[model samples]
Target: MTSAPSVLVVLPSLVAGFLACLGLIVAIGAQNAFVLRQGIRREHVAAVVVLCTAGDLVLVTAGIAGLGPLVASRPAALTAARWFGAAFLAYLAVAAVRRARRPERLDPAGTASGTERASRRAVVLTCLALTFLNPHVYLDTVVLLGSLAHQQAAAWAFGAGAVLASTAWFTALGFGATRLAPLFARPRAWQVLDLAVAAVMAALAVTLVVA
Candidate 1:
């Protein structure tokens, strides 16, 4: 039922959507911080990428399907989310600082069998919480991306492109960070990384609480 020109109209929107999502995603956030650490350690990188990508997909879809306005109207929900997110970020900040003070090699094979499974479980849960609890994530993917997609003639296609961008970015971030493992080989590098992460996380936490 769609004409050729009608289909072509979606291409620009698709590109725009991709760029828009990328601009928002490629930032220093809790989700990204965890992914980078996991990537460097090579611990469940694939799973983490999948979880983050799938989450973005679902959130973006919900936003485009008109969940943005409803989310916007719920100030109490956002407030709760803000508090939870801030608390989590604060915890991450402390963890990072501790890691910085006493840097350890992020050996994938170092963790014991029992501890590995438990740690992985904790990582997965943390990833989920980081992705879901952050109100900013919803605002970016759901509110901004959703709003942008609604303007496109090919809304679905545009949404697909945004989701694709999210997937590609996370995949690159999660996998590409490992390439820098050689640089992070030194404990000092990890200390610097964790310290920076801590600073960023703490600042974000404070910002969320006050804002």
Candidate 2:
């Protein structure tokens, strides 16, 4: 027994959802790093984008569909997520720091298509782990988006907007990174990017633990 939301309310909800999702997903993280790398390599870029966008869509849709309240009701579940996510992020941060120290440049000649590369299964599995293992993904797409979506009269519309935002962001990140291939051709550039990623992961790990 609910009526449709007015155009004003619906438009605002859509914009809110889009902006919120963009704000959260735009943060540099493992998932984004993989996508950017694949884009730069021109290897399985489409697959990575589709996988990430699909994962986010499902999480956001579920959040809007009422999973958010159930998750909120379970404090223990959130605690477990926080612990696991913090641990994983810490590990990734350490790994990034280590990689930064080594700083191997991408092969300049490897930009062209090559038969010998990361297999489809390997790529899929890696992206899946990067998406699912991160508790922040759940917190952002589920808890945060869910809580906000419910505030709107048309929650489904909000979720749709969020999905669109995710699609746009991943597409851009995966496809746009290739344009920077020249910059990343240098080992120093790779080192700088890895160091920045390490910093971001470390900060996120601390935030998760303290949150």
Best by TM-score: 1
Per-residue accuracy of model 1 over 89-187 as CA lDDT, tens digit each:
999999899878877654556563322322767878988999999999888889888998989877777888998999999999999998988887677
> All candidates' TM-scores?
0.92, 0.83
Clashing pairs in 1: none
RMSD of each: 2.4, 3.2
Query: Which residue pairs show collisions in model 2?
Result: none
Candidate 1 lDDT: 0.87
Top lDDT model:
1
